[model samples]
Target: MFVILVYDTAVERNPKVLKTCRKYLHWTQRSHFQGELSTAQYRALMAALDGVIDPEHDSIVAYTTRSPDLVESTTLGLPLGGPGEIL
Candidate 1:
């Protein structure tokens, strides 16, 4: 499965969220990440994020699809790297 994950969290929790996501996805922008994962990997990523995020305060969105062709991405300025590369 392919997943694009983005998040906003309390200032104090931002680092944790970023760290966790980077473990499984590419850090595409300030708060955006995308990568491919197996069902189990996806579940584990969510569970890890759950531990660091405040459900009441933090917001997370995961746009997932079984195939990359389901989405098109364009970069206006400089481009980031492949799925797991850091900015």
Candidate 2:
């Protein structure tokens, strides 16, 4: 499976988030990453990052798929709730 995460710059931007994600994903491009992982690995990675996000101005968008459809199917969503609710 593959995971794609998108972030907005105005709210918050952290290099650490990208650094951490690198352990699980291949840094495919700027502000975008992808990797092949099992369901369990993906879940664990997401769970590990639950507290590492800055929702006040930043966002983490995670999507999983068995095919390479991120470029064709990904859509951005408004950050809802508070920064703590970004998980």
Candidate 3:
């Protein structure tokens, strides 16, 4: 699956969240990441994040599709960290 993961974490837990996300996806910008993963990988990524985040304090959203081509995005300004889109 192609996944775009965005997270907002408490200051004290921020580094762990970032580190976990990076292990599974490309860091596209601050608090944002995108990449491809197998179904197992996707589950693992979420599971890993769940361990680091406090649901009461952190926010994580993931957009996913069967293939990268099924998604599209436009960048209004300079791309940050790299492109934010799957393509």
Candidate 4:
């Protein structure tokens, strides 16, 4: 699957969350990441993020597509990537 993960974390734990996400996804923008992963990898990434974030103070949103072929995005200012590449 293709995943787009974004987060807003409490200041204290922000670095930990960023580091954990970098292991599984490419950091495409500030507080945003994108990549492809298997079901297991996605689950592991979520689990790892859960461990680093404070539920009451942090927010993580994941957008996913069944395959990279199904994903599409466009950037108006600076291009992030073309289709099939990480968004």
| Top candidate (TM-score) | 3
Candidate 3 lDDT by residue in tens digits, 11-39: 88988988898898988888888999999
In order, the Cα lDDT scores of the candidates are: 0.87, 0.64, 0.88, 0.86
Residue clash pairs of candidate 1: none
* lDDT-better candidate, 2 vs 3: 3
lDDT by residue (6-49, candidate 4, tens digit) is 89887888789889998999877778889999999999999999
- Stretches of candidate 1 above 4 Å error? 81-87
TM-score of model number 1: 0.88
Assess every candidate by TM-score. 0.88, 0.63, 0.89, 0.87
RMSD of 4: 4.7
Candidate 3 regions exceeding 4 Å error are 82-87
Write one digit per residue (lDDT tens) for candidate 1, span 1-87: 999998888888888898899899977877888999999999999999998999999999999999888989998766765354432
Tell me the number of clashing residue pairs for each predicted model: 0, 2, 0, 0
Worst 10 residues of 4 by lDDT: 78-87
Worst ten-residue run, lDDT, model 3?
A: 78-87
Error of 4 at 73 (Å): 0.9
TM-score of 4: 0.87
